[model samples]
Each structure stands twice: as C-alpha cells, then as structure tokens.
Target: MGVEITTHVLDSPRHRTSYLSAGPPDGPLMFFVHGFPGLGAMWRPQLDHFAERGWHCVAPDMRGYGGSSVPTGAAAYAVAEVVDDMVELHDALGGRAAVWVGHDWGSEVVWSMAVRHAERCRAVVSLTVPYIPGGLTLEHLTPLVDRSLYPVEVFPLGQWEYMQLAIDEPELVAEEFAADLEATFAVVFRGGDPMTLGTPSFTSIVRAQGGWFGPSRRAPKMDRDETVLSEELLDTLVRAYGKTGFLGPHRWYANAGEELRAGRPGPGDSRVRPPVLFVHASWDPACETVTSRLAEPMREACDDLTEVVIDAGHWVALEKPGDVNAGIADWLGKTLRTGPHPM
Candidate 1:
C-alpha cells in the first residue's frame, strides 16, 4: 500500500523551505534530515521504505533548503533553532518524540535535538556523523581529532577549510559545482572501500584543490557503483539537485556557528536521555571506524545508545538501505513496540 504524504512550506524571509511527510497521520513518526548540499528528497528511499512499514516519515528541506523559511542571518541556522523546528513539527503532526534520523549536517541537527531536547525524541539514528557531545564549535573540536589522520600544525584547520571556502564564496561554490549536478552527485556519493583508512585529510586539499571536486571546476566522470546506488537512483538524485541550485542548501554550513561546529557534548551539557542509534558507515573515509578508537568515546557518553556498522560509505542510507532500515526496525521493535502517545 502507498503511504499518505503531506508537506509544509515555512517562509522565514531568506529562502523558501519545504518538508514532506509520508505515511498515516497516526503511524509511528520518523523525521529524516539531509546533509549539506542536499534537500529533503535525499531521504526518498528511506522515507519510502519506512513509510511502507507503518512509519510516518517526515523529511524537511531544513531552514534554507527547498521551500523552508530561510533567514539571511547566520544566527538563524543555530542548532537550537533547528531543534526547535523539530519540536514544533512534531507538535504540528499531533505527536511528539518521533524516531529522529539524520545524515551529515542533518546528523548534527539530530544530535543536537537528542542532547538539548531529549524529551522530544523517542530515539535518534545518526548516519555518517557521530555524536560529539560538548559545545559544537571548531575550537572545541581540536581534541577530538584523530591526530594520526589529522596532524595539528598542518591540519589544525581540518574540515574548517572546506567550511571556510563555502562561507567565503557561497554563490560561486554553489553555481560552479551545481553546473553539472549529476557529476557532482556521483563523485560526492561514490562509495569508498572498507579497506581505505587514515588517508590524508580532504580538508587540507580544499584551498589547493579548489573544493572537494579537486582542481576541476566541474566534477569529472565517476565510475558507477551499482552495488551502492543504482543508475536510475543516481539519475533521480541528479535531476532533483540539478533543479534546485545548491545555494539554498549549501548555505546551512555558513548558518552554523562555532558551537554547532564543535559537535561535542560539553560539561554540564544536556545529555541525550532518549534511546539513540548510530549507524556507522564502515567505508566512510571521512568518518572511518576501522580504528574503533574513533567511536569508543561516543559509546560511553549516551545512557541508552545502540551502534551498528554497515558496510557502506558516507551515504549509508543510500548505499545500504536494507541494512539501514533493518537496523532502525530492530531498534524500533525493541523500543517502540507500543506506539508513541499524542503530545
């Protein structure tokens, strides 16, 4: 059976925001947040899968993406504001504490929700990015670096370099990259192997290489990895992103601040009291887990957390939807056998 779908557009002056909801109004709800340079539609596959299995899935365009309200002020994109939107969204749906899932920047937002507004999340599933409790600032993130992969002196900037580029030339970066959205999506979403780890930081290459696509102004052709994402699926993504210039979505990075950038829980900081799940992308070179040491600290922080490793790259949900869905289903079975009550 097809799931029911509804969407809302919020206008915040800077941009138009769109959030799509699927499945029955009364079904268990799951909020899916997308990462940088992506819109709510990035969660299409997961939303389709979960909605069919009695989940009311909601995917938002976030503050600056799609039809959502986008305020020009960077402060509007703070973690607190994003978390507030989730809470308000839940209340609008006649429910509270939906199973929250995020990927990339979305993962950061979901992490903040669990930490700052634990009461509003029944459970959380974060993909790619892990929970870094503390203030979400670049200054606070220095200690969490795996020194071997990212040396202090040369790479102190780390991912900040990429962020800086985006912030400095948001329009140029968006227009240049979005010129061929297909090639851009393919290169960015191309799955890496589980064997490659501790490679030189990509952040270091940004200024010299001119962003993640390397020296090329446009993305080069990438080999199709059918095992991870099908050609048709890839085509759909290309079309979606192509139609929506990345400026609205990419700006979310500039919108975030030092606190949100840190992503680590702080002393006396709010803990994620709700049941949380983290699905590690085993082959994600950027957030590698072959070291084990990388995820160990996160496991120790949450009171109720579940960790599952999927043999996929940064795009875990897209690369291994079955495993992702199953991991989430298993968690839901154990945690939400009885559906959530209306708030």
Candidate 2:
C-alpha cells in the first residue's frame, strides 16, 4: 500500500482499455495482463512489489473485461486484436520497451506481443500458461495433453474440454456462469490442490457433464477461498463480472479456432529471442506443464528460457504471491541485471 493505484483510460478508434497505474511515469515500464474473469487488480500484488523495486507498473482491464470496452462477437477477441490493444497501450505509454507479465489468456496476448512487436518488449514472464509459439489452438494444445492422466479412450478432450464447451455451447456456458456470478467467482478463485496431481482435472469432464455445472448450470455455493482472495478482492471481482457478465471473456475461447486460422505464423514468429521466464503452477491440473509435455513447445521456442515451478494452482499469483514475486525478482536479477542489487 505504499503507492496508490491510479486509473487511466486508453481510448482508440477500435476499442477502449482501462488500466491501473503506479510508480513513476518515466520509470522502466512493466505491464501486467490479467486473464479471463479477472481485472487489472488481479496483478495488484505484482504491481506493488515491482513498483517498490523502481519500475513503472500498470495492469490493464483487457478488452471485454472490467471497465474496458466489451465488444460483441467472438472474432473481436482474437489474439491479433488483443495484441493490437497491447501495442497501442505501449505506444500511449510513450513507446518504451518494457517487461511484460501475463497469466491465462493474458499470456497469449503477451506472447503475441513478443512475436508481433518484439521491439516493445524488453522481457516477458508468463504464469500458469506457457507460450505455445505456434499459437494455443485446441489443434496444437490437444496433442500435448497428458493421455496418461486423461486417457484418450475415456477423456478424449483431456483437460481442455472446457474450451470446447465455449465453442460448442457458448450460450449455455455463459448462462451457467451468469446464473450465479458470485458463486462462479467464489469457485474460480479457490487455492490450488496438490492432491489432484496426476488425476483428471475437472476441466477434462466439462463436455462429458454437458457443461461446467452440468444440468444445474450454476456454481455450487461456497465461502470465499481466502488463501487466494480476500473478501474485499473477491467482492471487487464479483462486482466487475456482475456488471460486465461472462460473455466477453468466454468469447476468447469461442475465437480459438479463428485465432489459430488467422494467426498462422511467419518465419520465426513462434520463437521468442528475448529473455523469457515461465512460471509453472505445479498444482494446476488443467494446465499441467510440470509433469506433462505442455511446456515443451515453450522450452524449444525460447532461446533464453528460465522455468520455475511454484507449488500452487492456476491462480498462482493470487494463491502464492510471495513465491511468485520472489521467483520473478530472482529471475529479473539474474537475467535482466538491472535490479537494485543487480548481479
């Protein structure tokens, strides 16, 4: 709470993105991108820590989230459009090359930024989701699924079946989340579970169950998971989703096929030459990269890759902020060599 976060809007002809900023306006920039069902506030912990370390920190409410413009149509949420948002935001911030950090769908955006606009990125860090280089389509992702935990015979779609839910039954999935927004947020922001390792993640069964909550179409009532979210933070997220609804976020998945089709890579587009750090959530059963082949593409694509495994779930930054911050700090010190006590 050393520096208060200030809100600013980047308005463009195509879309409007709202963001939270802290630290000096002219300091080296650090942009934090949040995933689906999350706001710029999700990166509060990272923002505060990095800002204290003398970096200009900003986290944007990506298009279709929070106060940002929620454009209709799934195609509007494609990676190219989201990357364009980042490029424009960087330009609005004075065109300084900055370190980029992302989680979930945000990772996809930053990865694209590194590829499509490398000059704007000094370094990149990804949480939970790794850079897929070729783009993270079901066609590219399904092959990397761990068949042992999710056997092809029974769980044909693996942990990514939920993605299919968005494609095949978008309205139903959206209705289920909107049925009880608070409950949905409560369920989504829970801490990770190590006990579920090597097991089929609930995501793998979404299609088999007909939907996220099956016939009920609503998340089960539960208390907020304090390990991952304080009551204040949870309430903030619930309110944001309540106002914006889940259709825009879910549109990310609906456009996966199109993102893949339109995102065909040029020579070297898949490879990231900048210093890259990928933080793997060890307990993330859905995006299980620690014990699966999911991270292989990232390993091969990045020439300066440094991988760290945190014993937390998909919401690693929220559930274990200390470790996440420490990992990033350590990586930045060693790799970037521009910290206060640079090596």
Candidate 3:
C-alpha cells in the first residue's frame, strides 16, 4: 500500500485548522491551499504526487471551508485574517520556510503571504491565477480586463461583475449554490471548451442575470464533468460544501479592498523575491492570461518568475493533473530543489 494521506487538526488559540498531510514528518514542506467551495481534498493529486517524492505535503481546509473554523461575518474572512490563520498553521508545522501552492482564491492567500510576509515561504506555485501583489480586488483587476472581449460600455466591470454578488446579496448567493449541491458542482466543474475562449464569461453578466442560474435560482441539471473530477473527489466536495454552505466562500469576494491594501510595499520589501511559477489556464475565460493583460502586473512584480500555459479550464490542476504536476515538479526541480532549497 502507498503512503496514506492523514488528516490532522490544530486547535490554536486563534482558530482550528483541519489539514490533509502526507510524506515523512521531517521532509521538506509543500503547503497546498484551495479556493472557494473547495476543501483540502481538492489537491489530492498534487498532495499525493509530492508526498511520494519525500516532500511533506499539507493541504489546509482554509478558514471557512471543510473542517476549519467557519467564523461569522464577511469581515472575518478578510485576506489578512486568512493569512494569519495560514501563518499560525505554518508555525505549528515546524516554522520552516516552505514552498506554498494555491489555486483560485487560494492564490490570493499565498500571494498575500509572499507580499505581506515573505519570511514564511521559500517559493510559490500558483494554478490558474497569477500573483497579483496588489491583491485580487476589482480596483486592481478591472482595468486589466480584455476590453475587446469585454467592452467597457457593455461590460463595465468586465467579467468581474459577479464579485458584486458578495456585496449586494450574500445570503442569496449562498442559498442558490447550496440549494442543490450535486447539480451546482456538475454545472461549475466542466472542462475547457475551446469555443468559449474569447467569448464573454458568464461572470461578466452575473449582475444583470441576478444570480448564477438566473431566475432558475439553482444550478441547472447536468452530468458531473468527469474530465475534471474523480467520483470519490466529487462526493467529498459535495459533503464538504453541504456541511459548510457557501457563505464563507462567497465572503472572500467581499474583502477585495482590504486584500488590495494589504499588498502594498512595507518597509524594505516591495517585489516578491521568492521563485514563483504561474500556471495559466489557457481556456479559462475569466482569467485569460494568454490573451488578456491580466498577467502583466504579475510579470512586473516578481523578480524571479516562471510561466507555463496549460490547455485546460479554471480547474487546470484537476482537469490536467499530470500536466500541472509536471509543470510544478519541473519548476521545483530546476529552480528550488536542485538549486537552493533542497529537499
């Protein structure tokens, strides 16, 4: 039998963190952080792969997800708050400078760590989302949207209009997504569709449409996208979201201002100095780094940056796990492991 991935919980004075861990306890640390409506289990592929190679892999159920403490109020889910939770967790796990990996909103958390406090991380690998040193706020992102694809007159906020859901109607957003877990997961987990490349993502019109499923109020019935999800993984996600609901995840969108403010230069640290590998989702309409200028800030902000374009959708890590793992392994082997931060 392979090395078993173990579940652990740290009850710190600040909060309770439930994380999945593998590899030898004394091995080099590789922390994996997930995004909205996700658990630490979402990173099972990367966690298992890295663990087998003598890297201690830890994927945490961030603040409001899975087995972690789900604090009430959107203010409690701010970027600074989540960053503190992670740093505390890091301290409990031996206080070593480890390589951190994140996807979607998790990218924001890791990036916040590097920008706000670089001492905790040796390197960072981001999937589908690039490092935005100034945070993921629309104020920092809307100007970077593809104007041709999302014209200002038509799409004033670009594909980020959905962010308003958190501000305008948080309960409704949570209620709708939690209304039917299976259909919601299936609807959102589809793999890339090349035909939808330059088209306006559904996110651009979320405000006008009212909700994710418009007047329907819940996800439309659809088959789970097996291309991106294993049956076991899918079931686990449903149960996690079922238990937590969507309030905590949706609250992440409400704290963009604080996140952006937290990323500004302090004291001597301005640019992110750690080795960064940004994995872009080529077919993701909302984050089209290949075509849009969405990745420009990241290019200018990082002193040491590596870029790889993966032919997949938003769920690049899940849909193309081999490619994602290969990209990170190549970067780590070439940049950190063999060069400086050896395992």
228 in model 3: Cα distance from truth in Å? Answer: 0.7
What is the Cα-based lDDT of residue 308 in candidate 3?
A: 93
List where candidate 2 sits over 4 angstroms from the true fold: 257-264, 338-343
| Rank by TM-score (best first) | 2, 3, 1
C-alpha lDDT of all candidate models, in order: 0.71, 0.86, 0.86
Q: Candidate 3, 112: how far from true, in Å?
A: 1.0
lDDT of 3 by residue, 1-343 (tens): 5568999999987799999999988988989999976889989888878888889899999998999999998898888889889989898999898899999999988888887778777888888787665678887788898888889999898998988766789889999999999999988888998999879999899888888899989999998789987788879988898889999888888886475555555434557888899999999988788988889988988989999999999999899999999888888888875523332
lDDT of 2: 0.86
Worst 10 residues of 3 by lDDT: 259-268
User: How many clashing pairs in candidate 1?
Assistant: 21
lDDT by residue (158-267, candidate 1, tens digit) is 64567667777777678767877777766676666756665764655575566667656777877776665677667756766655667756666665543444553455
Across 1-343, the per-residue lDDT of candidate 2 in tens digits comes to 4677899998999999999999878778899999977999998888888887778899999989999999987789887888888888899999988899999999988888887777888889999898786677887899998887888999777899899888888778888999987788888888999899878999988899898887898999998888998887887887888888888888888665343355456535567878899999999988899989999988888879899999999999999999999998888888766543321
TM-score of each: 0.85, 0.96, 0.95
- Per-residue lDDT, model 2, residue 48, is 83
Which parts of model 3 have CA positions greater than 4 angstroms off?
257-269, 337-343
Each candidate: RMSD: 3.7, 1.8, 1.9
lDDT of 2 at 158: 87
